[model samples]
Target: MTLDPRLNAFRPDLADRRLEGQVEARHFVDGRPERVTVSSAALRREPRPDAAQETEALFGEDVLVFETTEEGWSWVQLQADSYVGWIASAALGPRGDGPTHLIAVPRTLLFPGPDIKLPPLMGLPMGALVTVTGEAEDRNARYGLTTPTGAVVTQHLAPFGGAADNFVTVAEQFLGVPYLWGGKTTLGIDCSGLVQVALAMAGIAAPRDTDMQERALGTRLAGIEPLRRGDLVFWKGHVGIMLDGQILLHANAHHMMTAREPLSEAIARTAARGSAVTSIRRLG
Candidate 1:
């Protein structure tokens, strides 16, 4: 008998006997592009705009290589915690603008009025898109931006709208738009960007990222027990307004971007995704 090769080890066993065959690495993983090794990996609790995970180390059995073919399938070879999945190439790429300017390590500066470096935007890359909370003249730095991560970095930041009642109404105007990543305008917007700009228009300063936005609004709530028009409805990495007792309006990536989904259905989806009921901050 010939010795088994990596390509032959993957062959399915015929009857009870094993016949080795090598399986392409990407075949088992979901949403993989050209074949590539797992340069690094992480576990995400949820597959969403705001995915959070405690992170775990990689193991040889838990890894997969990307395929060289087109129209490839993804999703397999998951880690032990079952938090890892094959994400599409699009989502895997650098977020917010191109990668050239993402600083990864920005110069240290004081923020929110203090000479400190602990909170510096040193982690962000240049051209990384971030929501500006406001800027100020620090005793030590040129500028600082209150980042979507909610960190007050440096003193200089681009202008960002604040959260207030009026901004909620302004966001409503964007109903029925399409969802586009890295978009911050009415032309097209993702769940978080839509909320950010809409709130900006109304002068409601909300965070640029979904996780930060959730923290920026409302009291902790459960389900849709107390719903009303203008109440902020939180979903998996998305936010919407309670147009009435039964409806929510905001840009969504699941389907039609700017559309309305009933509170019950929306809530059910959140449960199905296994996320918690974060809150429902009223805007109007």
Candidate 2:
């Protein structure tokens, strides 16, 4: 019964108080809740800035901070997917009221005021959460007034709990986005990141890596069954979503970006590299 470090806050010296009896540590403490305040903050495997980034904490996502170091790093676990890692302390703040909305589009500008003509404060990626206090209209475009200050295009946001009809369509919107090993935003994304983010929009809570996903998601299809849209295809360490019976869409290193190609071509290429399709899963 080994606990996964990626989902548990534990180290040789310290651990979450909740795991008191299950794990051994020199000390344990109850973690304080916090919220991500930056557009995106790298969750690294180590506290150092140069450490390998394992994932990202998007703006407004809640987390439990187990420890903070003088060097400005915080060991925390994301509330959305339970991934644990070290994030910059500055990227976190007091967890206020829960988020009211999430960015539904690939990305949207956050203006300083209600007017779109003003310089934008930042660009919020899809899945970034925000608390909309009210609405404002300028010229013809409408905006949602976010807490503290900042305005975002009203149409680009969807209320919390609102789910997209098809997660596959959400994944399709990221076509051509650059491939990145640990990225989860439109600027760049990885295979599992793409799947996790897209499935989230459709109200499906998925794990963060291909192995986790392959084990936890949907029902496995038999080798002889016909493939269809939304089926997930897995290889040794990679994954892709089926666009239809014949096409596969994924953010892959081979393409260096999100791309769509015939499933047979992907199979041939992967097989040539000494891997074959390990499984196909159909979401229930």
Give the winner by TM-score.
2
CA lDDT of each prediction against the hidden true structure: 0.44, 0.94
Question: Candidate 2 vs. truth: CA RMSD?
Answer: 0.9
Model 2 lDDT per residue over 1-284, tens place: 99999999899899999999999999999889999988999999999999998988899999999999999999999999999999999999998778899999999999988998999888899999999999999896899999858999899999999999999999999999999888899999999999999999999999999999999999999889999999999997799999999999999999999999999999999999999998999999
- TM-score of every candidate: 0.40, 0.98
1-284: candidate 1 lDDT, tens digit per residue: 54322112132221101221323332232322222122223333333425543232121113332221243323222322222233333223222221111111112222333345554423222112343444554565544443333343433222322223455465566676676653444445567666665554454556555666677666655654777766776765667777887888777766757787787887787788786556777653
Once fitted onto the true fold, the runs of candidate 1 whose alpha carbons sit more than 4 angstroms away are: 1-165, 222-225
**What is the overall TM-score of model 2 with all chains considered together?**
0.98
- How many times do residue backbones clash in model 1? 40
